[model samples]
Target: MRNFIILFKKEMKEGARSGKWVWLPIVLMVIGISQPLTNFYMPQILEMAGNLPEGAVIEIPMPSGEEVLIGTLSQYGTIGTLLFVLAMMNVISHERQTGALAFVMMRPVSAFQYMASKYVAQLCILLISLAASYILTWYYTNILFDHVAWTLMLASLAVYSLWIVFLVAVTLFVGTLLRSSGGIAGVSVVFLSVISLLTTLLPKYMEWSPGNLRAEASNILLEGEWGSSATLVSLSTLALSVLFFGLAVYMFKKFERFGE
Candidate 1:
């Protein structure tokens, strides 16, 4: 436990120093900002274009402030999720290639401890990224609406955090098994793409598969009934996260460090 804490702290320091935490928030900010910016200007932008000749003056209604905020969260939330997927898609492979793992492995830590610490570190990064996006969304929305559903928004953020963890676990598995970051990223994308294709082409049973979990959440947030199904999917995704992290640990154990 003490070793884990020490290693985790080391990981966090490296992440902070590398400006690694900046990418997701920056992408999310653009997404969040786009909502208000577009809502505020879109109508005027359309109106300024001198009266359309005919059948071209599409009636574009200005979005309500609340609606803008929700749109921001949903839209930017997805962009942020993709950014996280890209960031986490290279956990172990990069470390090994750059000799970063050698420094830690040489120290008296067991392979399990080392891998677990990395997993936890990735989890922390994902949580922080989600929290940062939530904060930005709340701040921006409050500026325009002056009143927001803090509880519901926060709950949504929490549920989405599980998805980030799941992706990180998949990343860890890829990074550990593959020797190159490009290889890891390529494999990850291919696997996810196949899952997505299958989910679309297959029957209802495959609908709730892991690849479709994020899409399901978006549906609930945007159009569907947020009932038992959402809760079930979130729980199932979290369980899969645990399983993937464990698989990462097992593979890390099989890895022969400091050798060919």
Candidate 2:
């Protein structure tokens, strides 16, 4: 526990130095805030950009707060995910190349402790960024669109965050398997894309897929209640996260043995 805590703090400090502490939240906030602003001003934007006949006004209907949030989430699913993968791609690989990982492993820290610390630290930053983005987006939604209940917004965020958890777990697993940051980023993106593609092509079979987490979150916002499907997906995501972390630990142990 003590070793894990120390490593976790180190990871956070590293994040600060790497500028992840600044850029991620800022980019996500921009992405999240843009949705509401864009939806609220679509008519003006169209009028200014479109070379239509004079006095021809565009009647753009405003979307609900929930809908705006869903747009924010879609941004997270794409750009946010890519940034996260890039941020984490070199988490371990860079340390290894620099011999920092060797020095750390030479101490009393075990593979489990090292991997756990990295996992928890990265998860904290990503989740916090997502929360900030969601909250700002929610605030804008309330201002520009209909007033969505705080309970619904919070509930949807909680559900949607499971996808982030699953993402970290898989990325950690891939991080352990590869030494190149570029390769890690590439493989992680491909793996995530394949999962999403499979879920879309085979929804009936992939009902419990983590890729459906966004839809489940949207459902929570619309229904304002935790549905059975959300429960299943959340549970499945948690289980898979644990499984992937365990695999990462095993892979790290093998690497340690080879280094010895």
Candidate 3:
């Protein structure tokens, strides 16, 4: 417990120094807030950009708050996911390259404690950034569009966080297995993309895939109810997170053994 806390604090400090504390949330806020703004001003934007006749006005129906939020989430599914993968790509790789990992392992720290600290710290920063971005977007959504229920908004956030959790676990596992940051990011992105494609191609078989987390979150926002599919996705995501983290620990232990 003591070692975990110390490692956690160290990880947090490293995150702060790297500016992960500042940049990611701000970038995501920009991405999130842009959705409602663009949707609300589509007609004006179109008029300014297009050389249409004076009497001809483009008519675009304003998206509902729920749709606006989902649009924000779609942005997250692409740009945000890429950003997150980039942010975490070097987390473990840097430590290994600098021999910091070896120095830390020479101490009394166990593999689980070391990896868990990294896991928890990264997860906290990512989740908080995502929440801030989503909440700010939700606020703008209410003002610009129809009001979204707080219960529904928060429920969707929780549901979507599970996807990030799974992502982080996969990242840690890959980091432990691979020595290069580019390899880590490439493998992680490819894996995520493949799973998402599989989910799209085989929806019936891949119903419980973590890739379906965004859709489930959108469904929660639009429908405002927890169905069996939502529950299944949640459980499967949690189980996969644990599994990946465990593999990371085992992989890290082997690295430690091999180094000795």
Candidate 4:
């Protein structure tokens, strides 16, 4: 445990020096700001596109501030998963290349402790980004909408956070297994795209699939209701995250440490 804590601090310091620590928060803030701004202007943009011709009429419901906030979260949050993957792709690769892992492994630290510390560090970054974005979403929505369901909105974000976890787990697994950052990022993108395609083509699996979890969260946010099916989806995502992260740990052990 002491070794893990020491390694964790080392990982955190490397993260700061690498400038990776700044990227997630910047990405989150950008998405957070874009949400309310777009929501505030969407109606005007639509109106400028002009009304229907002749007797035809169109009535588009204006998105509430909550809807805007949810939109921003869901829209950019999905894309933001890739940022986590890309940013963390080199966590182990760099250590191996730089001989840093050799120096650490020469000490009392075991490979598992090294791997687990990296996992925890990346997980912390992911949670921080998601929590910051969601909280900002709620704040901005409240500013624009005036009336908001704080509990439900925050609950919805918590549920959606599982998808971000799953994404990070898979990316960490890839980073540990692959030899290069580009390889890690490429494999992650391909894997996620394939998972997305399979889920869409085989809609039967949608009920308990991680791919559906994000979209389900969006629906819950928009409708302001928590369906039992959505809860099941969240459970499945959590399970997958645990399973994948466990696999990452196992893979990290299999790798020959630097200088070994």
Q: Estimate the TM-score of every prediction.
A: 0.81, 0.97, 0.97, 0.86
Error of 2 at 46 (Å): 1.0
Rate residue 132 of model 2 by lDDT: 94
Better of 1 and 3 by TM-score: 3
Worst 10 contiguous positions by lDDT, candidate 3: 251-260
lDDT, residue 214, candidate 3: 93
Compared with the true structure, what per-residue lDDT tens digits does model 4 show for residues 156-226?
77777777778878888888788888999999978877787777888886668877766776777768888
In angstroms, the error of model 2 at 210 is 0.2
Candidate 3 to truth, TM: 0.97
Instruction: Tell me model 1's lDDT, rounded to 2 decimals.
Output: 0.68
Single out the weakest 10-residue window by summed lDDT for candidate 1. 216-225
Q: Which residue pairs show collisions in model 1?
A: none
lDDT of 2 by residue, 1-260 (tens): 99899999999999999999999999899998999999998888888897899879688877888888988888888888898899899899999999998899789888999999999999999999999989999998999999999999999999989988999999999999999999999999999989988989999999999999999999888888999999999999999999999999999989776335
Q: Which residue pairs of candidate 4 clash?
A: none
Off by over 4 Å in 3: 258-260
Tens digits of per-residue lDDT, candidate 3, 1-260, equal 99999999999999999999999999999999999999998899888897899899688877789999999888998899888999999889999889998789788888889999999999999999999999999999999999999999999999999989999999999999898999999999999889889999999999999989999999999888988999999999999999999999999888767335
